[model samples]
Target: MVLLKARVPRAVALLGCFVLISSLLTLTTMAQTTVTSGGIGVHILFQTNKWVTPNIHYKAGTGSWTTSPGVAMSASNNSEYPANDGWFQFDSSTATSLEFVFNDGVGVVWDNNNNANYKVSATGTYSVVSKVSDFKTGDLVRPSDGTGYHILFQPITWAKPYIHFNAGSGWTTVPGNAMSPSTYAGKFSAANGWYEYAISSISTVEITFNDGNGVWDSNLNANYVRTSPGTYAFVNQNTATPTTAPSIQGYVNGPGYSVTSASETAGVLTINLAVNTASISTSYGTDLSALVVTVTKTETDSVRVKIVDKNNKRWEVPKSVFTTGTLGTDSSSTSDAVDALYSFNYTQNPFTFQVVRKSDGYTLFDSSGISLVMKDQYLQVSTTLGSDLSVYGIGESTRDNFKMASGDKQTLWARDQGSATPIVNTYGSHPFYLGINSAGQAHGVLLLNSNGMDVTMDSGHLVYQAIGGVLDFNIVVGPTPAKVVSQYTKLIGRPKLMPYWSYGFHQCRWGYGSVDALRTVVSKYKSNNLPLDVIWSDIDYMKSYHDFTLDPTNFPQAKMAIFMDEIHASGQKFVPIIDPGIPDDNNDYAYTKGLSMDIFIKDTSGKPYLGQVWPGPTVFPDFFHPNAKTYWAEQIQLMYKNYSFDGLWIDMNELANFCPGTTCYDNPPFAINNVNSHDAIYNKGISTRRIG
Candidate 1:
């Protein structure tokens, strides 16, 4: 009976053991590991032009990845490479970077250099800066003779602004937008301001500044002129010979002849031609602004014009209209000119041309429409402010109203001005710019200051500045709008790429100090058979985050390379954060360097702007200054040279305004005091901008 009882107990114990084991197994099966078994992510194809599937599988966190309709993605030297397959964006004015993902599953990074290895983070917009077409010249130079017309060559276009030039002694200092060659800054010297261009778009020009006993004065009448190989429409008669060296002739205005201005600038050419003259016909800046009015003869009857723009690919209008009366006599001889009532056709949008005339107010015929159009539009010194908006049909005056729509037009404002109150018309107006076309391409303008401004497509905008306002902006024109914004298209933009290891995985927390603790984590990765890469050293790594100098206690014998080497061998990297804040302590290396160089971002008090960041209350670097850029670049160079790390992960470099977006702290060391300092380094590659 006792033996039978022992057998029954033994059987019950064995059954209990089986139940516990089964429960444990169930738990393990229910949980996920490095790899999970579940739904696959969105299926996609790479540049290889081959089919790839998660089914080809790699281990991931707690989940297994599998693709439906799985196929092996492959690439070789076989298939033709696709155009702009994949790209990375890294745009900053000074530096713009981009990387391409080829069809071969190969990733190539480019910024300061050509194709290098790179990675992408979350998928988004992308741009390719590689082999991007760039025109020879940039920005327009406004002339003081009268500040309306803007001329350029690349995609030859013309514009008229409230901009005007003034009569002066040396360079025509217009107090506003452009700089006269006489006052032009730098070593452009012989190749300085407003010289008649010798070639298309880009021509070696000269601009000189006269300090005390200057070479050339601002009196356009007295200054030397450079005659180009091109000829005036009427005088040349299509049979004129191309002259190697040409000279501009001065003529006298006669009765009924008026003035456009003393000087007009198109690109670098600045002309100060008077009312009318009887001499060989001559053209000024590439724009019609310099085609000074000279009355060969004036008549009671007026001539009508069917104007057009013949600058770009072809003329945008027709001929016929330009008429003239009989020729008049000059001091030396007689000539033909146009009459007073110069009526122009309203159908054509923008108009520019040269008029030939007879002396003493007699009428002269208008040249063919072929030479009428120019690059950019110019402001005409109208007898009256004719039609509020001349070229474009936008606002004519403060009272003129024009509607704006998201799809059709893009109105951009410069320097958000109104701040709730301050003046009677406290409605400090916003400076707005329009798209180049129905699609907003060809040109883009960002007026960088708070002023009453206007921007138009066919017509143009005007602005008012304070402190005698300096017309400053970042302007770009292209064949298409997409090309202009390939870098940072605020409307729709590309994205940055993640580091390869970053794609695999990243594990982090507040602080990570002590090599042993680091080693233990490394060992865990090895034992678990999981993939891990970065071991971030947060604030703890720095002695109060002063940056550059490391904490000996936290990273002893850092030179041994053992710590970094161990991770590297496993094909991983270490990243440390470097915020733009330098401690207030006088001894801080960064702070001291800034003070020594006069390069700290200053407040309204003309002292450095102070703020609090990760480390402590710190001073921001006045990166807008040239010296500051050099200093900042040096720091980056040191990181690569001294630290021997692969690359950097820049943070807090956006000049981000913390509490108030109204104030992003301005330091006027840039050329036009534009937000981007002349020295600021922009990522040149597409990927850099996106990642940033």
Candidate 2:
């Protein structure tokens, strides 16, 4: 039987070339250390190491140097490495004081601050236990004395709100934090509702507001940061205010901006927009300096219109996740107002445009009602919607029965928050949504920008407030929902096929304690004749809940190997969970190697951004790192050789961090604190959840 092959091609295979060379060079310096079947208990098993064939270089105190066991399999091609779960192991059996680090055949690549080595107490300890870490615990400090701070809360629909914050220890609640409602409400401003708090000596503070009831205003992962020192406020401009027939504020009310240049060629219309920037005050930039709108007939039923800054470059998704090429050749059409089964009407100034489906004359998108506000750092795009239109899938969050009702506001921000909550940013971000009109005609729209924003569907309009990035999106016209989905998958890759046995019965949980316990569960399944194809465990199997190490007392290496062998013998598979955060453990092999490879995501200060996770604070791997594939492959090989599991269970992606957005070691760029603002989103919100 042929085993599954990793689809990495030669072009991408070079991602690990440096790792391979470093591994080969390191071998001569260190002998092949071996792991005995004894029960000394491997204390820390580090995952997320980027090095190929990581060897734990250790010297406790001033004692003789030692290396951990070499990986049982080659790291170059870790097909059996169980998907993306890779780990490296280390043991400090005979150390009085532990101060060790990792090397990838190259020189020392120390953790964050100036080659700083992590020190641990190993007196009377067989092996030093380590959890996944982001910073050297001491990096984040809180003061004992208090300092005055202020926050603004213009709530959309909350009553009697209170502020909860961390006062050096855990969460502390204070009542009546919401200030008076704002008086001035318009395109640029909202009423001020302020709250003040005294945060003592803490370097970082996380906060969330609640409405005496169960309802809370925790954007994304529940806690936002208060980074700047002294008194400051975060405004929520789009607060739900009492309005009698209140129209959407950002649309063109009167003769707004004027079109200076207009032309059409090959079924494409180009228009230059001139607007007075002085009118908008709350925007990031002083003015809407240059704007060019382009409408292209990319498909027979589909059309794409892009409004962008003429000279300045905007941020888009780094990877080619969006469909770059036109799905089909542009259809030829002659009518200036209509062409290729579609027609669009627009105003030269206060630029308003509407695209209509030629067949039934149905309006797919219309911006004639509201003014389009395009700021340097902020942009708002809105379109009139049919009353019966139903929308689905502006993702990374949960909704009721996979459908979005009218009057619903959805925030698009990829975060580490858990999935159980309704209306919170969860694990992945996909800025694509399918809208179905009253006649059951389905179409899809994809906003190809990665900036943070809030999308609202009012009674008859869809408003998009992107805080950063260009307003680039595609409209897929499908009379049927299935065709719309087909067009979407063609643009952004399709899902992979799962193995047949994966569909079978599986038993899994977090707290499986020992090998005997796991064995007993397997035995019970057999006794009941239950058709179980796979058995799974969470972080509990690791020593101190670290990624790679199994519990010495509960899950001895010898016993675990035997258990896995027996399970595989019966044609049953075993799977274990792996997370993205690598704890900062100098003594652990994974952290050391990762530091050397420089694969971690950096912060605004150009240092590794540390966020709290299941393993405590941890450094996240930059999946966009050039050597990410090789680093991942090598780690998986290390894990597969150590624990012969059938597959891996990757969790805690969404790069979940317990660190709130405002207090993150590296705050995300262009982050907006106003929760109710049209462009409000928890940018770079680190997600955190307990492993179950």
Candidate 3:
């Protein structure tokens, strides 16, 4: 019953020393930290303390590998780690987080090939690298083992489409396992043993294996890079028989550079032999001389592209370096760029080409570490668009000249500002703040990492895509909203259905003291039944709102059990609001118990935050902080262990800053306001809705 083994270093294990350390390309402008913003903001500094463990990555589309607790499992294709190879991904392009995390990341998961699932706890810019990990205990394996692989990317479908393994004959694949349109799980496509599944592309090929022992082996070929958006299938050329795992070695080159530009127009110029990809989202030196550099912005995948120059230099090209499209045409991605590019007069720089993992930004370069460049020499392209450009891409935003346009310029910005605050039509945080397309279809984006955070859509681009990040969200795409929601729930652990009354309307304010004052509202709704429901309770129903206890002075009979029974007996439901903030009286049972269990959120001083809430200065449990959430959820069972809660009402969720809307980013669990927050998602000229 051994499960997984060891960790796989992103470079060494997964890629297997494809290039010598010295050959590792040097960056002319290497980012100290990688940050991306949309509905949410993500920042990762690989050179920092996080370097202790190499980046984790795998080649599957959106898959997983797990075992019993304590079993060691990792992702990689190299032989370095005992067990390597387990990483899954699904973006809004297929099945990712478009509504959460600024709608800017993808979802990832592992399978028992069953129901076990987990989600991204943190939602931001993070990195993962796949490597050949060592054997520890569980099922995690290495690519070299020849077990087979699956990589799926289906933007139009979302039922568990995958490229899987078939044991009987040759390295037969199993498609539709990871991307099915049906609700069933663990189903296989027999007609074509689709080993390497892809609704869009296949980037890397890696695998896991069991040798009838406690050990497992893994290996991968970094050469698998996709050139288009479609499914692909790769058979293990070495399956039926065992053979020595192949070793691939390549070279790493440039980091920065100097170029010669031929300036011809206001914001466009052609640079020769200079390479830049990272700059597509930023600004750098001009290869072209003075021309009227009013604004400078470039576009592409909205991330820096690592280009391997003919001289073999590896430099990061800023996203703002190249001019992109407008309400018109985009020749850059089009094969006929030489045609429609007339608006800006752009041309491919003979010297540099942008390179990235076609599957996703998971890896910098393909196995060959080479991709051609198509710099939008502004003078040659569109007139309405120039270097000081306005463009957008997945998990993208601006900072340090790496913005939508020059001087923080935005090509589009609009919000629902009214002459009068529309008098709360519905005043409650709608967990259903998701955006849908023209078809009234909402999609699901399941975030993969446990390191949680919020994500948002750009100010105007309510429906954007997240190319890559640590926040792997399950991408549930669909033509229908309900279908989207159904698939999404499975990705993040579904929610329990509530009683019918929970769906009806109820009036609740903070000041309905004395059950009679509350009973009056209930009686009115009951007599009318005008599509009305349950009685509302705020604070007076509690014994100082301590939770799990009733106020003796208020209504002793209205304890947890009685309240629930009363509501249920009426064919109704009772929903009590609970804030993340926990009371701090050392004498209070809940507080003292939480403190003793060491499950409360700590301050910079490393103690619980005694903040003022309805509870009157309490310790707000850190739901984003893993341990706190586990203990917090368990505490629910602790209270409900005796009496169950019908439906949970999470309040003060945005940390409940009384101020509302936006707040400060100060101490622990502080609020942050930026384009990455969903507060920025606004429809420019489109309508959105939920499908699932």
Per-model TM-score, in order, reads: 0.31, 0.59, 0.34
Q: Which model is ahead, 2 or 3, in terms of TM-score?
A: 2
Flag regions of model 2 displaced more than 4 Å: 1-257, 262-270, 281-285, 322-341, 528-530, 661-692
Candidate with the greatest TM-score versus the true structure? 2
- Across 1-692, the per-residue lDDT of candidate 3 in tens digits comes to 11011111122211112221101112111221122334343222122111112222222124443122212222222221111122222222232221111100111222211222222333343322222232222121111113233342222111112333332233424231333222211111221222223222232423233212112222343323433232232223323221111111111122323344544243323344454544432121122221111111123211111112233222221222222312122212322222221122223332322222232222111112222212111111001122222332212112222123221211111221211111111111111222344334343332222111222222232221111112112233332556655544433335555544554555554444555445545555555543335444555566777765556765555454665676577765554545556777877777877777776666556777555656676666654444665676666666565544465555444344221221121111211122222222212111112100
lDDT of 3: 0.31
| Global lDDT of each candidate | 0.30, 0.56, 0.31
Clashes of each: 102, 29, 162
Model 1: lDDT of residue 439: 33
Tell me the spans in candidate 3 whose CA falls farther than 4 Å from its real position.
1-496, 529-531, 557-567, 624-630, 633-645, 657-692
Ranking by lDDT: 2, 3, 1
For model 2, how does the per-residue alpha-carbon lDDT over 572-691 read when each residue is reduced to its tens digit? 888777777888777767777888899887776676777776667688788778777688778878877777987777766655566655332123223432222322233335421211
Q: Per-residue CA lDDT of candidate 1, range 354-446, in tens?
A: 322222221122222211212122111111111221222222111212442211121222221111111101112233233334432333333
Model 2, TM vs. native: 0.59
